[model samples]
Target: MRVLSCIVGQHNLWLVLLAAVVCVAGSWVALRLLLRATDRHGVQRSGWLFLAAVAAGSSVWCTHFIAMLAYDATAPVTFEPILTMQSLLIAIAGMGAGFWLALYNRLPPEIGGAIAGLSVAAMHYTGMAAYHVDGVIAWNMNYVVASVVLSVVIISAAVGATIRGTSRNSLLIGLGAFVGGIVSLHFTGMTAVSVTPFVTGAPIADATVFATMAVAVAGVALMVVGTGVASHLIDSEVTHENIAALRHLAMTDSLTDLPNRTGFNEYLHFELQRAEQGGRSLALIGIDLDKFKEINDLRGHEAGDEALKTIGRRLLNLSRGGEFVARIGGDEFAALKRFRNDDDLREFIQRLEEALFKPLTIEDLEITCGASLGIAIYPQDGRDAERLIGNADLAMYRAKADLTRTVCYYEPQMDEKSRERRGLAMDLRSAIEHKELELKYQVQKSVESGEVRGYEVLLRWKHPERGYIPPSEFIPIAEESGSILAIGEWVMREAAREALAWPLPHKIAVNVSPVQLMHVDLARSIHEILLETGLPPRRLEIEITESTIIADKVRSLDALRRIRALGVTVAIDDFGTGYSSLDTLRSFPFDKIKLDSSFMKEIETSQQARAIIRAVLALGKSLDIKVLAEGVETGMQLEILRSEGCHEVQGFLLGAPETFVADVVAVEERRIA
Candidate 1:
């Protein structure tokens, strides 16, 4: 076996192409195996299978080139030694270059295989031609012709595999096979050249020469067609997987991993269809976790998530045949059972309540959570999924309102409250945009100075039909509906602009909800408003509750730091109402602290409340943070706060949150003067 000396003792490069043909066969089989082995879970293992296919393919390529040169040994009688020496050296270098290029071409699988195959055929032809062609460097025209034909075959195969199939495995196999066939075709041609050197003087009729060339061309065409068919099958599999994922997303809550509102709707529809077909009634039970915020404040969101996951699992396990349970919204879940009467469903809900109340162990500590459930029997309490779900949800809220796990049926009165919340959410959006929500300054004066220095921008929503609605009723509603972000931003911008407009020029404080603070661009919005209003950062104050800051401390701190960096003042509102640790206030740069009103209200009757206030004042003074007392309604409370060295005071005693009516501060100043 001798065609050229490249590796050692006249290596045959055709042998390398021969091994590639064998690898093509092996890759074909692996493609089929990979397609069948890949169940839904098996899709994750696709990367390893692909590697194995590529390795087998390159090996075949390596071996074929090595064998080709080895077979070209028959030369002229006298110059056999010199010819053999030259060919063997070229063959060895060609093999090394082929392997190196294979690595470069293996990137990103699909197109890599097609390009690598054609490149190898081109490289082998060039490497072989370097032996004895011209003084000015001649090229192999036949190799160029072969490469063009082979490239066309490989490209056609890839297009076919991509379009024809649903499965990914088929396309990969089709790609590997198509490109591989083109490269191996060169080896078949080499085999033909040696076997029929000079049988028919016409140079085309020789069996060995003509047969190998014909077979090589035909092999390219056949493999291209074969691979093209397999590619489209892979596409089908991909489409099927996508549809399943979309359906799951439509039903499931991404955060809680429970079925959401839409999911509950679809599930109820399906259950009703089954129930109607079977002539049975369906029991729709809605459950809402009670006091979820307490857990969030006491244990943190990590514990809250664990509680939800634990509750979800417990509810899923409790559901029986023809029963479906889904988490419909925040702190809300629904379950439907194909049972007649509300009594049995009520009993099941009772058991669910007890199951939910039982202690759960997460991270080695025992924790407790409870649920309030409401039940409505299908066909008895309205007929459709929407009506049943709405009735159940209304009952659950009423159950929660009383702080009881007792199952209640939906009453006509509950719809009024639901409609009220919907109307408020809609009005809140309009109120914010149309400037219907106004800032009423409740003057915060320095008790010692007796001078009006700052004002808390209290939001007053004046409705045409409902009169003035207090923020206490609508704020929580806005926060729940996610309209708080827009409202909060509007409040901050308006407060800043109005404070800058005030002739007295006192600092203004605006409140931010946990939802607003958690928004990543909270600071950007604040900075833009300051820039737009021409208000100096020093004159504006952003008030956040302790609970809001610690909601997601890391992210919250990031927002706080950005706001603080703008030189704007930050004060914790309702500080003592929550579990505000002294260390948290010390860690953050706080310009002021507004003592919770409940603590101030209790100061008159209770000595312990006064002592707590004293300790807080001392802590504030030690940290150099100015202390302000909120809800100072009585003169006695104002005097106590004055003696305590409280920096500022705000409440009904000073002035209630009244509409400024062009210039209320000026009118109030004249009355005080």
Candidate 2:
């Protein structure tokens, strides 16, 4: 202990401490650089590894010689050039190995730590061997072994802390490990040595050694900082690219690679304002693909996606100068087109139709999909974006509803109708909740027996102020507004319950909308309703339009089969009015087919209608399915249907729809008499 105190007193303590500080600062900086190098993505990171080796190696070498100057030996102390140079090379090689283990191989920190501790021990012992003294020196194996062991344990712990700890904490750990290990090893090694006086020998000057090491340390520090700066630039570039990609994804549709609804709305608003100031009119053409749901049903969704992409490409091609095209919804698109004259606008519409009418080929199938376009002019239709878009949507629906019209202009009457329909839909929700809807029964008579077979349940709604609203008006409105799900369920539950109180053994036929047929759990709902009403499945018939199955054939057929499995019969209503294929009847197991009312109106005068009815009846006969003719209002029409061998008939001629069942047995007896 006295020898250690005398040695510390002999040298300049401040310079010794400053050297230790430099050791810690250099080590911390080197560790940070190595960490940054490993974090970087590519080949450019390798430069930091070399920088770490140089900084860490130079620090240990400088710290050792600086402390050696404080040795205070009797003879002058100097370093052997070859041995000292070899120690520096050994230190660099050891640091390189430690870095490779921790960064490249991704070994646990303890393993890299052990390697790092051993590296420092090797450099320290090798530098000690380079000591030139004019005395015979003896080493105590106990102290020498203790110094090496202490270095290994303390340096390893420091390396481990630096590796495991966060960035800010790592610096403190690195400083402790590097400077602490160097000082501790040197003093412990000094304790092991006993020097005996002998002949004097010349030594290297302290001033020259100190100046050279200070310059070396400064060079290593610069290298580490430069590498760190280069790595920061690379990371910044990568961050910029990622941000740009995110922005593009936010505004663009991934499926079609076109502007999405948000992007479309932004562009539309800007264009609308530009047109208003310039005194030029702009057109918002809202486009809806007709029978798109059918395509999705007939083909899978994958094919449907391909069809949408194809449509987007075609629309892009048709977009003229100063026009913007975007896909706003599923099966819906919008275009903002500017025009100088009415004739140019008409020409653009004609060109758009020509482009869309062309067939799209997808995976061996050629699909001919048509589009319905609704044009809303700026300033005339609306002043704001929301109003313009809403008016355009209403016009699109109007064009879609009429088979002959492919395009329709926004009319003020359409908005009034839309508002009325929306108001009716809102009221329908309340009506269903309050049980304001009524189910009227229309008798279906057997043509041959003149007996009432069953009654078709018809929905009726009467507004408080409007008196009575027709089903044709409110039913469609309810459907479009998605209020039909609740209303339809109520109708089924009510009709099934009402049948239990009727005096007649007549089956109740409840109409199912296309939307209602889309429910996968329709069978479960019906089962619950049957359990609630205590009505047998045999007495409940679900009548679906041909359009219902045409919308989503697989799903609707699955729903029908499930319902039929519950012992209830399924019938196709308004059959001929829809695109009913004879194949659909063969494929789907329908128990009955109700001929459309339009066919019956012409049956009295037109032989073509009569012959068509005969063919349908013949088909039904061959298939062993009952064919009921609807809308038999005139006696002559009933007679014509009878001659054609219609199985059942329902119209005002037989009986009108009555709110109450009204002693149904008496009515049947009266009809028979």
Candidate 3:
């Protein structure tokens, strides 16, 4: 009690209060650093824990001596150098042991508190022993024991708060308890000391040296805390960068570096919501390049990739502010734009064509490609992203089919037709397995004697519910969906097997789709079918369109030669419709030319049609290739064809393709009898 009264009366009050505030501030920062260090990598735990010890130990050591420096005991007092330094070593060693246990989560909260309390007692008493007053020192054993026990209780409270702390409030509570405990330990230990004054023989150590040491301790604490905070920030930034890179990879196309379908869908939906809330107009445009597959087939996939990259760059450059463009499929792209007026929409469409129509140069080869675009407007075409894209897709199909207009807007009727087409395509996949499909035959007759020379095979589908679906509606769907490959092979086997049972020596002609002509193994597959069915190759004929050969002339010609070498005849059907018919005929030899029915329809009304028919007949004679007239619906058309020396004819007038072969044979028997 006498020691407290003497120091309080003489000590500088301002420095004592400053020391108290600095203690709390320094301890808070050190605790934050310690927690962060412990949470980091285990392999680096010791390194970070060492830093924590530096920060924590220096803060406590500085606070204790700073308060001690404020002490004015009325007698000159100098600290013993060895004992002062030993107090600091004790502080650092104890902090390291406590932190190590806490970092590894090995000790209980109470046990950590006991360690901290014992450390405080050791450091405070050791530091007091350094204060040489040139007189004997006495201690109150009861107060000394009380100080130690009070430190235990206070430090225990701090440890409890720290263990339970996760948020700002709990952290503040923990810091308050810890700082209170340390300050209490110091003052209580001071109250236990009593000194007797005497005349000193030795001069007191300079006060300036103690002040310099105090500043050095504070600087070390600051450096440790600052370094830990900087590292944490850098690690956080690196983690964010890695996440962004992964997101970009997920959203972008690997080949063209454009937003893919998944990214496009998300962007479209975001724009749609914004436009809806603002009552603004939005447009979704679907674009598909014409004959892109042919480019890939003729050039190479690498060239195709370069072409696509060029297209993506061009489209990205052409996009206006608030507009987005993406590649949704191979050879297919899309654009979304916002507009306020019809003129703006019109101008956008015009610019789109100008940008897309530009030629692309890949590997020093200039390639020309045209794009077809379809537009669907907001609040008019659809209210949602999915419906809008679908409607635009339907309009794009119409634009592709109509040669006059390469860009068209959505119409209500197109939806119905598109839905029907989609439904038919889905159903057609299972049609063969269900036995819902069959082949009918139409007789091809000799124009002079009217003798049946061959029968053209026709596909007919009788749906269980829809009843008698027309070939014109479903055949094109099958071809587009790529289901025709399987259907075609099925037809060949069926036709060959049925023809083998026929009594007459007539050929059976099956129409081959352009898709089937692309297969290199078609000839080999057909040979296997003929052998399995026991049908002579001479009795089966493969009919293809001129467009098929025009697509890939060399490949088509090679495939045709291989099939013809099997003794199967190859004829060109719908001859005049394709470009360069005569050139095709000259380059590739065909067994027969079925004149397009447009001439047969025109032969009655126009002399030009008759003249063309005669010219074709004359050309066929010169080449020794037979000419046949298709779609001969009237006697007048048949008579005109016969007069023009057409060797064979087949149409509705003579016979619509019969569904049953037995009926056809019975009719032929009656006519012959």
State TM-scores per candidate: 0.56, 0.63, 0.70
Clashing pairs in 3: none
Clashes found in each candidate (C-alpha, N, C closer than 3 A): 56, 0, 0
- The reply for model 1, stretches above 4 Å from the true place, is 1-281, 291-332, 337-343, 364-366, 397-408, 432-435, 480-486, 580-583, 640-645, 661-663, 671-673
Query: How far off is model 1, as Cα RMSD?
Result: 14.4
Q: Per-residue lDDT for 310 in model 1? A: 81
TM-score of 3: 0.70
* lDDT of the structure predicted as candidate 2: 0.80
Q: Report the C-alpha displacement of residue 47, candidate 3, in angstroms.
A: 6.3
Which pairs of residues have clashing backbones in candidate 2?
none
Q: What is the lDDT of candidate 3?
A: 0.81
- Minimum summed lDDT over a 10-residue window in model 3 is located at 6-15
Off by over 4 Å in 3: 1-212, 376-405, 408-415, 425-436, 442-454, 462-468, 476-490, 511-533, 541-673
The 0-to-1 C-alpha lDDT of every candidate, in the order given, reads 0.66, 0.80, 0.81
